[model samples]
Structures are given as C-alpha cells and as structure tokens.
Target: MTFGQQLLFFFSAVGAFNGLLLGIYLLFIKKLKYLPDFFLGLLLLMLSTRVGISVCMYFYPDLPRIIPHLGLSALFFTGPALYYYIRSSFQQNQFDVRNCRKVFGILTLILGAVGLLYLFFPVTWENYFGTFIYTAWSVFVFITVYQYYIFSKQKIVSHNKFVLPVLLSNVIIFLTYQLISTGWIQVYCAGGSLVFSFVLYANFLILFNKKYHQVAVKETNNRYSNKKISEEQADNFVSRLERLMETEELYKNANLKLSDLASRMNMSAHQLSQLLNDNLGKSFSIYINEYRINEACEKIENGSYLKIEEIGYEVGFNSKSTFFSTFKKIKNTTPLLYKQSQILTEPRFQSSNL
Candidate 1:
C-alpha cells in the first residue's frame, strides 16, 4: 500500500480499535447495570468489527476469505444492536425487553445458518449471502428510523438528544455502503471505515459529556430533598396510584419503568421511591412484581393455554425466571404446583371452563 493509503488505514483503524476498547469497557468493566449501556456496548463492538474488516480489505485486497465473512456477519448484528439500544433507552410499551430478546434469538439462528453455508460454499456466500446481509442491515436501519419517526410524531421521545445523532450517523453509514454496493462509488471501503471512526468518537463525546454526569449528581442530591408527605397527601396519592393500576393496567406494560411511572404520577422518581419505601414499606420492584405475580397466579389457575413463559410476558415480567422467582416469593410455591393445588381444590373451575 502507498503511504497515503497506509495513513488512511492507520487513522481509520485507530478509530475502530479505540471503539473496540471502549465497547469492551462498557460491556464488562462498567459498574452500572444500565440496559442501555449494555446495548450501546454491543452496538459499538459490532460496528468496530465491521469497520475493522473494511479497513483490512481496503488495505489488503488479498486478505483471507474469513475476514470478509466475519465482517459481513458483524453487519447482521449491527443494525439489530442499534435498534435494541434505542428501544432499551426508552420506556415505551412498544419496546418490550421480551420482544427484543425474541428478535435477537431469531437473528442468531439466521446468522448461524448463514455462517455454516459460508464455511462450505464461499462463492455463494460472497455473491448471494453478502447481498442478503446488506439487505438485512438496510432493512433494520430503515425500521429503526421508522420507529424513531413514530416516537417523534407521538412526542414520546425522551432521550432524543442522544438517540438522534446515532440514528443519523447509522443512516449515513448505511447510505455510503449502499452507494458502494450499487457501484456508484468504487473502492471506498476505507471511506466507510473513516465514517465509522468519526461516528464512534462523536458518540463517545456526546454520551459521556460532563453535563450528563451533573444530571446524575443532581438527581442523587435531590432524592431526599423533601421526603416527607402529609397523611392526606399520602392517602390521595395511594388512592390515585391504585386506581391507575386497576384501570389503566399500567403494570401490564413490560416497559413501565419506575421513572416513567413517576413521571405519570407527576412526581420525581426519588419522591415516588420515598413514598414507596417509607409509607408502603416496599421497594419499587417488589411492589410491581407483587402485582405481576398475582396476575400470573390468576392466569395459571384459569388454565390458560399460554405457556409459563408466555404467562410471564403477559403479566409484564420480562423473563420466566423473574416471574417464577417472584411467584415463589409471594405465593410460597411453584406456578405448576399451585395450579395443581387449585385444580384439586376447585374441580369445577377445571371442568366448567373447558
């Protein structure tokens, strides 16, 4: 490679390498258990892998066949990671964790099958499978943008300051790849990698700004600003809270986060937490999980056709393990055994229903 090309590769490759390290830090080293952070780490890792491949092929045309395959494989997950990160960062019912995991599982099987084919028929993978990957990536990018459009239209986008730039950057990268794929631009793999480098660093600055840190600190300081509520106020708040739970069935939403609930109730999250802890003597999770477990018990006793996991999803628990453990904690037995006991004691419910 000429010096110019080598320099281009160095700058671009540096970005990809730095992004990889940052991604690893967020995924494994970060102490916070934030779901958005996890998804963002996965996104950065996938994008870095894809860009690294471009950097290699741009500099080394005679690279091993496996490099291209791995690059394209990473592209498959890149779009999904972006989609899931956006979904996880928000508290909308449309972006349930259960659905996110379901889509991820489907994508895994797809890429797994494609990977096996690539191992045996390299030419087919290059000609057809590569196109499929680009197509899938394009579709995912479109879906993510469309989903964001819906959120924007409904005025439900709380974290747009962070999400918009990511969406825009991915769209540009997608457009660049499409241009190259369509032969509009030739031998611009390095250009795409360069764009990834820019996007990755820009995201780093945007996400890790000092302003966000101040926000976190301010929230912590304000958590106990005025924790005490009068008896009448507490009674009214509880009544409204219960009414909302019963009528709106907010607990049915798998993405009904504590912050979102506090916003709906016209209070800060800390205030809500104070009320929950001081007055109700329960943490937010236990309170919400109690409702979900009760609903699961009702569904199990009703002899619903849905599987146990499905029941968990229906009651707003994101996973079967959470539902089962919460059920055991509250009901003192497993769901299946509880169902059997109910059936034995009330045989009419079993016979008359079906």
Candidate 2:
C-alpha cells in the first residue's frame, strides 16, 4: 500500500480496534451495574465491528466475502443499541437492571435471526441487507435527534447537551456513507472509515474531558440529593404506597424497613428514601409515624378497651414515650387530651369508656 493509504488504514484501524477493546472492558472488566454503561459498551462493540469490516474490505477488496457478512450482521442491532444507550442514560435510577437484561435478550434474538437469514439466504441478504441496515440506522438517528428536541423544549434536567455531539457524529458518519454509496463524493474507498474514526475519537475526547466527568458526577449526585420526582411520578408512587399501606398494613409491623416499603413499591431503597424526602417532604420514619399516629387516632375514636400505652404498641410504636411524643407532635395535643376530646365529641366513645 502507498504511504498515504497506510496512514489512512492506521488511523481508521486504531479507532476501530481500540473501540473494540474499550467495549470489552466496559462490558466485562468494568464492574459498574449502570444500564447506560452496559448499553454504551454494546454500542461500541457493534460500531467497532461494523467499522472494522468496512475498513478491511475497502483497503483489501479481495478479502473473504463472509467478513462483510459478519459486519452486516452487527449492523442489524447497531441502531437499536445506540438508541437504547441514550434512553438508558436518561432513565431514572430505579430503572431495573433486570429490564435491561431483558432488552439485551431481545436484541440478541434479533441478531441471531438476522444471522440465520444471512447464512441460509446469502443472495437475498446481499441484495437487501444494506438497505435495511442503513434505513434502521437513519431512523434511529432521527429519533435520537427528535428526542433531543423534545428534551430541549421541555428543559428536562439531564446531560442531553452532551448528546448533541454524539448525534452529529452519527449523522456525519451516515451522510458520508450515503454520499459514497450514491457516488456523489468521488473519494477513497475508505472515506466512510475516515469519518468514523474522526467521530469515534471525538466521542472518546468528550468522554475523557475532565470537566465532563466533573459535571456528570456532580449532576448525578445532585439529582438524587435535590431533585424530586415529577409530579406524575410522585403521585403514582404515593398512590401505590397508600394502596400497599391500606391493604397490607405494613407500618403495623414494628420491624418494617424502608427496603421493605420500597420493594412493595417496586423501587430501590434509595429511591423510596428520595421520594419520602424530596417528594413527600418528610423522612421515611416520619412518614411511617404519620400513618401510625393516624391509626392511633382511629383506635382512640373507636372506644378501644386498651389503654393509650397499649394502643401505641398495637399501632407500631416501640415505647410509650415515643408514641406519646409523636402523637402530640402530629395531633397537636397529648394522646389523653385527644382521646378526651374524641369522647366529648362522640357520645358513643364516652358511653363505652365510662
């Protein structure tokens, strides 16, 4: 190969090869359980395989035909993985890892199906696979851009500003290939590889920027610490929790834990804690105590034979002092005073108590 050709090969090959390595590291070596990381790894793997195959066939046109087919198979899922990576990145922390695994399973089935067709009907694949792959890719890119537009319009609090470059990168790579395929750009056979390498490294630089990490870490922490769930989400969480409380009387168990409540709500313990603190404007303990205090009030009104002290234990409090203090704070009166008021208002209670 000529010197310029060698240079072209070296730069493009480096990006594709290193992308493969990074993809493997993120998928297997990195221990993070975050959904975005896993999807990003998969995206990288797909793109790397696709780009590597493009680079090889462009430079050495006589290579095995199966090499291109292998790369085409990767293309089948590339768009889906890209879209998912962005989606997962924006998802709330409660987005379950199990769900992501399910997505992965579905994508794998798609890839396997495409591979089977490629194997059994190579002629059909050679004729139509490229159109299907590029069309899928273009649609995903458009969807991603549309997502950015919606997010920007709503001013959704996230790192979507970073997505702009990624969107542009993919657009450029796609256009480059489209131009070459249409014979509009009379360039080297590896022109698509050239753009792919450039964009791939641009993404790498964005990822490695110190300010990016600082902002990302800060934003993530700030989200959990300060950001409340959307009103809709908050309402949904409250309704679900209320239903659980009414049906199960979970707070009646003195040993009831935050994790237990969160599990009932299908959320993480931290998510429930955040919900209580930010959305409900209370701590988990206080939230549960409010339920207990209300239950205590109902018991007092019902002319229960048990004394206030026993009623406290019945409701869930561990001690007389705590129950009395919490009742006064919640009800704005001592338990006995509150009970006497109930007796005065409700003749039945007075009759039963007397």
Candidate 3:
C-alpha cells in the first residue's frame, strides 16, 4: 500500500479500536444511564467515517453511492448522542426507551429520505446530494456544540473543556472536504487533511473520556477510602443512603448534622461527606439544603398552609431570608411565585390528571 493508503488504514484502525474500547468502557460504567445507546450511536459514527473514507478511495465509481449516504447520516447520532448523554448524566434515573426512541426515530426519517432520493437520482445528483448532506451534517454538529455549551453551563465537568476542540476539528474536516470537492485543494491534501482531522478529533475524544472516567473513579475511591470497601460495596452504601433519605424521617430532623448522620449510619464524617459530594455530585451543605428546600416547598405549596418563616424554620433554615435565598437559588424563583402557581394549578390537577 502507498503512504496515503497506509495512513487511511491507520486512521480506520484507530477509529475502530477507539469505538470498541469506548463502547466497552461506557457499557461497564453501569452508572451512566442511556450509555448503551450513546455508545452504539458513536460506534456507528466511527464505522461510517472510516468506511466512507475507504469507499471514496478504493471503491469510488464502482461503489453504490448509498453507502456514503448511510455513513454521513451516522454523524447526526454521534454528535447529538454526546449531548444527550451529558444531559442524562445530571439526572439519577436510568435512560428509558421513550428518549432513545426519539433519537432513533429522527435517524430513521433521515435515512429513509436519503434512500428514496438515491433511488430516483443519477451519479451527478448523488454527488450533489452528498455535498448537501455534508453541509447538513456540519450544521447538525454546530447545533450540538451549542446545545452542549448550554448543558456545560449547567456545570457538567467533562464537557467544560472538550467541546471546543472537537467542534473546531469537525468543522475544519468538513471545510477541507468542501474545498477538495470545489477543486480549490489537491485531492491528496484534502483527503490527508480530512484523515488527520479525524485522528486529532479521536484523540480529543479519548482524552475527554479519560478525564471524565478518572474523575468518576477518583470520586468513588474518595467516598470509600476510610473503610476501603469494594466499589460495589460503596455503591450499595450510597444507594442505601439515598433510599433512607427518601423514605425515612431520620434525615428530616432539623438537628441533623454531618457528624450525627455519619455516626448513626456507622461511618466516619469524612466518608459521609465524600459519598454526598462524589456519588450524589453535591456538597454536603447543598445535598442537605436540597432536601430541606423540597420539604419547605412542599409545605408552602401543599395544604401545610404554613407561613414562609414557619416553613423555613421547620426545614432547618436558620432564618426566613436564608431560606428565601437558598430556595430561589435552587428553584430559580420566589416562594410566593411558586405558591401562586401551585394554587392556580391545583384545581386543574384535581379535576383532571396532570
């Protein structure tokens, strides 16, 4: 094989290997909901990009144009799935069929349209459609980057750094291909640059995955370091804590403190703090406040009919102003507004299912 062919082969191999390893890692994490769908989408993207390049070189003119169409279509899932995965990470629930089906449904439509178009088209038309598809692909990626920025603003740590480089690399790759098609660049430079772009982008993906996984593992270890429990044991402990907090009234005590809770749970304060911070992804104060705020909101909106000050005091707030500020920060609105909305919605809810 020539040097260019070898380079293509290397990138194809790297892309495949990265996809395989990443899929395995995501599957095994077991904590990330909807990870399987995200991994499957990404694997399709990797295979599509690699195989598209191969078809362009070795099989072009002889290849059915629909292959490239299928490949480019995979880009939609790869970018959007990454954003979806990030959003899902913020919630504790497992990923469900309803959400995954939404993505697959859109992909099905795109693929169906492309196939119908290809069947009625000629070679020149297919080439034009390919360029159009590439343009659409680029736009899709740009939108994903923007959406990811919004999610990162909500404080996802991994996305906080990785989106920019990957976004830029993808744009550059698309532009290089466009230039080549327009005959502004030599064929070799165009293809070589595109391959190089994927390689760099793949490296960014690997680094991002590494940083995220390392942080997750470190946080998990910190939570279990004192008793040195296995990861499964630590997960069980944290799961039990979550369940107890939800079902038992013990955590609702106004006098509850980190040390007190730790002693009751037969664990050290440091360990408890780690579990709250790492596993639950919040500081101890924040975690406690979340529960307190929810309880206060309940009293305010529900028939508890307590005064704001009384609700605050009941939920462990030292002062009404403190409760007001904390509640506003968490719920992004004033207590009175929340109460008014709840009041207006109550009759509708009572009369019919919400």
Candidate 4:
C-alpha cells in the first residue's frame, strides 16, 4: 500500500479504536443509565467493529474468512440500533425487562437468519444480501429523520438540537459509503472515517458541556443560598400562573414552552424553572401537561362532540401518540377508556333522574 493508503488506514483504525472505547464507557461507566444511552453505545460499538473489520480486510486480505462475516453482522444492526436510540431518547419511561426482551428477540432473529444464509449459500450471494441490508437501512434512516422532523414541528421538549447533527452525520456516512460501493465515487475503502470520529468526539463534548453547566449551577446555588421564598410569595406566584393560564388559555397552545410562559410572566427562565421545581416539586412539562389533561377530562365529562383525538389536540397535545401516552401516564388510563367510563356514568345518572 502507498503512504496515502497507509495514512487513511491508520486514521480509520484510530477512529474505530476510540469509538469502541467510548461505547464501552457509555454503556458501563456513565452514571445516568438512560435507555437511549445504551442504544447509542451499542450503535457506536457496532459501527466501530464494522469499520475496523472493513479496514483490516482491505489492508490484510489474508485474514480469516470469519472476520468479514462478523463485520457484516455488526453492519446489519447499525440502523436498528440508531433508530431505537432516537426513539428512546424522547421517551420518558424507564427501560425495563420487557423492552429488553423485545429488542433482543428481534435482533436475535435477524442475526440468526443472516448466519444461516451465510452458512448455506455461496460466497457471492452475500453481496446480494448486502444490497438488501443497505437499502433497508436507508429506509429506516429516512423514517427516523421524518420522526424527528415531526417532533420539531410539534415543539416537543425532548427534541435536542444536537441530535440533528448526529443524525446528519449518520446519513452522510451511509450515503458516502453507498456511493463508493456503487462505483459512483473513487474514494478508497468507504469514505467518512473522519466523519465518524467527529461524531464520537462531538458526543463527548456535549457530555462535557452538560457536566460543566451542572457544576456551575451548583457553585452559583452555593453562593446565593437565598432561593427560598415565603409561603405568601409562593401563593402569589401560583395564583399569577393560574390566572394567566385561565385567562389566556395558553395551555391550549400545542407548542407552548417553559421559556415562553416565563417570558409572559415577566420572569427569567431560570427563576421560573426554580419556582416550579422548588415550590411545586414539578417539572415545567408535568405542570403544564397536568393542566392539559385536566382540560381534556373536563371535555370528556361534558360530552363534547369532538373526537378523542381532536379533544387531545384541543387540550394542547401536539400528536395523538404523545397525547395518548401522556394521558395514560398521568390519568392511569387511556383517553378512550376514560371517556367511555365517563359516558357509562352519565347514563346511570340519567336513569336515576328518570
């Protein structure tokens, strides 16, 4: 191999190695064990393995035959891992055993089928399988991108601006590799190793920034030590908040944000956040959504002619899925079920009157 080829190989190896380590650290060492973190870690590990093996097979063709198959298996999981990571990032529920079983079962079936095919089929057939895998992966990526777009439109609080850049990196890597595979580009050995490196490092930087902000907040809190307020002040804040919501019906705005509410109340965002957390012991989302859910219940009980989905939207939910999920979470039952129970009670009351 020429010096240029050797240099690319070295850089690719370094990226893959660092990615593998980062994935392990995220999975094992990260204190906050969020489900999304696990999925992201798995994605990073799979990507590193796939890239490392591909680089190895290119530089040392005499390596064992099993190496390529292992890499292909890792490649097969990349899209699914990424999709789940994005999905779980926005979810509020804790990851449980049931979720683990479902994800693992599906992954097992896919890998098992691929393994069987490789065991029985001619070596050349694997190329056809690669085409199908990549095509499916592209479709999944598009679906994920569309999901995020919808989230953005709805102004979901969990939608992180950083997620877009990470997703874009994935899309770019996939497209560049696809172009190279199809002989549309002359780049040597699947481009975008540096891009993958950038993404991994970017994640680290985000994490660092978050930690730094937390520490800074802690220091400020220690110095001020006077965030507490009297009961009268708390009541005043609560009354003002309620009056604003009652008068303006701001809760009906599907895209309402904490900062928007804070601005309307003539308070700094941090002050508003602290008031909610310290006084009410509720996050802004929970407090706002409680009002929304209460309004939904009133609509249901009043026998409004609107459909359940319409009622959800009218009460400020941005999407039917989110509305149902949050309603179930807060109300301890689904909207349709709650409405049906209310209807049943109404008939009993009418019969009693008769």
- What's the count of clashing pairs in each model shown? 0, 0, 0, 0
What is the per-residue lDDT of model 4 for residues 1-354, given as tens digits with 9 covering 90 to 100? 899988888877888899999778878888754566777788888888888888888888999877877887787778877777776655434225477569668877977886787778848566866676677678778888888788678755443335665677688778876787788878777355655666667777887897797567656655644567568887898899989888767787666688678767766567778788989999999999999999999999888999999898788887899999999999999999998899789879999999
Between candidates 1 and 4, the lDDT winner: 1
Q: Could you tell me the TM-score of candidate 4?
A: 0.64
Report the error of model 2 at residue 251, Å.
23
Using all chains and alpha carbons, the TM-scores for the candidates as numbered come to: 0.63, 0.57, 0.50, 0.64
Model 1: per-residue Cα lDDT at residue 114: 82
Model 4: colliding residue pairs: none
Q: How many pairs in model 1 have backbone atoms within 3 A of each other, for residues 3 or more apart or on separate chains, i.e. clashes?
A: 0
| Global lDDT of each candidate | 0.80, 0.77, 0.61, 0.77
lDDT of 2 at 252: 68
Cα-lDDT of candidate 1: 0.80
Better of 1 and 2 by TM-score: 1
Instruction: Give the Cα error of residue 147 in candidate 4, in Å.
Output: 1.9
Mind giving the per-residue lDDT tens digits that candidate 1 earns over 1-354? 789877898988999999889889989999744677777788888888888888888778899878887888888898999887777665544457788889899999989998888778876666888888999998889898888788778755443357777778888888887888788888566888888888877877877884687577558758655758878898888898888777666786766778767767867778788788888999988888888888888888788898878888888877788888888898899887888888787867667887
What is the Cα root-mean-square deviation between model 3 and the actual structure?
Answer: 12.6
Q: How far is candidate 1 from the true structure (C-alpha RMSD, Å)?
A: 6.1
